[model samples]
Target: MGIKSFQGKRTTTNTKESEPILVSDYMTRNLITFKEEQPIEEVIETLIKYKISGGPVVNEKNELIGIISEGDCMKQISESRYHNLPVDKNNTVKKAMITSVETIDGNMNIFDAANKFLESKRRRFPIVENGKLVGQISQKDVLKAAMKLKSNTWK
Candidate 1:
């Protein structure tokens, strides 16, 4: 047969219509952050007070250094009598937090963000912009994003 129209049809690579989801669009506007020097007790208090899972750890200049989750605190137990001897209360959150942090940008796609969350130990993602903490996103957000994508794609 002669060359069909489908044979010469160009597939559009334009993503303009399929805009990538961003953290700013779905991230929780309420941001909870702890100073690296704050006591772990304070971190616990904040979590219970706000009913949140975790928060980002920042330095004096507001640069993200790590994250602290309730799970981290739950794992801290003393096996020895002195081991039960608590860590120095004076120790900062930096001492207790996972210094190696994984982070996400607000402008990134939710698909990528979700992958990072699932692949790492952290499910809470600190949404940052220009090196400043702006908001947070969790697995819940990722789930919602997936639902949105499923809906949008069909529409």
Candidate 2:
């Protein structure tokens, strides 16, 4: 119904692969997120407990700040040279999060969102509404949409 863009990628779709899918239709509304001040141990526990590869980092007002991923934790692990002790005993997401966070709006079309993910390097993006996190989208969302397209199930 509308158009969106990110990193110069258009979020509009019309053809088989050009159709824009609404965020509400494909986004994970029940997504998990963390705050920047949260300890790295929490990040590890959350990732493992939920089996999630990553999640958005936010501030006290729920404003999206950055993101933490398995790669980041791996970085910490490697930096520690495989020390048995916690590598980030006092570290927080603020110190370790990737500052250049990518985000999308709830009204954003799935096609555009998918393009951003592909063109960019992030597999997941925090859904932002007025800069506040509302949901999340992952590569799985794009694949799900593509599956429907293959069957011509998109309405």
lDDT of each: 0.77, 0.81
Clashing pairs in 1: none
Tens-digit lDDT track for model 1 on 1-155?
Answer: 77668657689876766677876688997677888778777788899999988888877777788888887655442322256676557756766688776668888878888778878856788876788777788999888888888897855
**Whole-model alpha-carbon lDDT for candidate 1:** 0.77
- Which candidate number has the best lDDT? 2
RMSD of each: 5.6, 12.5
Q: What is the TM-score of each candidate against the true structure?
A: 0.72, 0.76
Per-residue lDDT tens digits for candidate 2, residues 1-155, read 65565568657876555555687788888768888878888899999999999898878888888899989977877877677655768878888889887677778777887788879877887778877788888899878977887787646
**In model 2, what is the error at residue 149, expressed in angstroms?**
3.7
